[model samples]
Target: MRRTLLALLLALPLAAQAAAPSALKAEDVPSLLKPPAHGVRVLALWSLDCAYCESNLQALLKLQRAHPREIELIAVATDSVAQQDALAQRLHAAGVDALPARAYAEDTPDRINYLLDPDWGGELPRTLIIRADGKRSGISGQLTPDKLATIAP
Candidate 1:
């Protein structure tokens, strides 16, 4: 029983690591947006402080649920590394903590923002849609249901 208990304790950290969201870097943006063999990649950039981010997240979640297989939603938080715990909590509250996500891991997020999109201006509630063919469309501000439908469709 002691041996079994030790093994379980060793596995606990691994399990927690597997469940935690990953830290995103500026260099990681390209790979994250790479189109899958099938379906479009939807990248949503938000922050817990953004007033409209929750609504945008809800809309994205709805879109994801509608086309579970055809659309892949990835959330990026434009928050500092120090806010990681709170970021995770906010994502949980928004019902997207389970989605593949990342928080800014750099002290200068503008560099990461530029890597994400040269014209983005680091705006909150930004969404990017990458088609299977590699074409990308980006929009800043909360995504409307109509816009979400058009992208997912």
Candidate 2:
């Protein structure tokens, strides 16, 4: 029983990490930009190395929690599939593991970034807001409450 319990404990973490974010190749970018059938879609583009990304992600998740019915938040990590483990750890630490998330799986991250926004310039912590009416806005850098209001409001 002791050996069995130890094995179960060891396997639990691996099982949880196995559900890490799905791959987000260049082709998947367009579908993500499409406006949701209802409510707003906030596509948060981030990378593990970005200094401000964690805070920005937390803020976005908070906004989503406040207006769950009005907002649909999707987090896409700009890191390649090789960084999947770190990305998953960060998202889980931020308490956002439940949100729809993806990790860059393309050969180059620029392809995904360009598809996300032509003017993005491969910046970290970028956010693309899409409204139900099909209007879209892309914001880079840390997102403040004022910025969050633009989509949540």
Candidate 3:
């Protein structure tokens, strides 16, 4: 029993390490808008202090859940990679840790934001809908049901 307990304890750190989000670099920003061959890509852009970011994430998650094959969720936290642990905790708390997520790893966040959307100006809870047909749209606030509906697969 002691060996089993020790093994479980040792695995805890590994589990936590595996949950950290990937790094989002400036160069990778352009590819984020590329239309996938299948399904809609909902790229959720958020920051730690955004009042409505979590709800927006949850709403997007719900939409993905409702249309698993039709919707793909990519959540990117605009927070620095240095704050990865906090961002991971927030994503886990929001029940979106399983989705593909990344944290900004570059020193110039404005550059990254501009790449994501030239008109965005670094707003929190920004969302981008990329369709399979090379169509895209940007939203700079919390996603409403009407907004969410527009990306339904």
TM-score of each: 0.84, 0.88, 0.91
Which runs in model 2 stand beyond 4 Å of their true positions? 1-11
Clashes of 1: 0
Show where candidate 3 strays beyond 4 Å: 1-7
Worst 10-residue stretch by lDDT in candidate 3? 12-21
lDDT per residue as tens, model 3, 1-153: 999999999998786676678899988877888888898888999989999999999999899999999998999998998997898889888887878888899998888888888878787888988899988888889888888888897
**Scored by Cα lDDT, where does model 1 land?**
0.81
Indicate whether candidate 2 or candidate 3 has the larger lDDT. 3
The RMSD of every model to the true structure, in order and in angstroms, is 3.5, 2.5, 1.6
Cα distance off (Å), candidate 2, residue 14: 6.4
lDDT of 3 at 118: 82
lDDT of each: 0.81, 0.86, 0.87
Model with the higher lDDT, candidate 1 or 3: 3
Q: Mind sharing the TM-score for model 1? A: 0.84
Leading candidate by lDDT: 3
Model 3, position 110: C-alpha lDDT score: 86
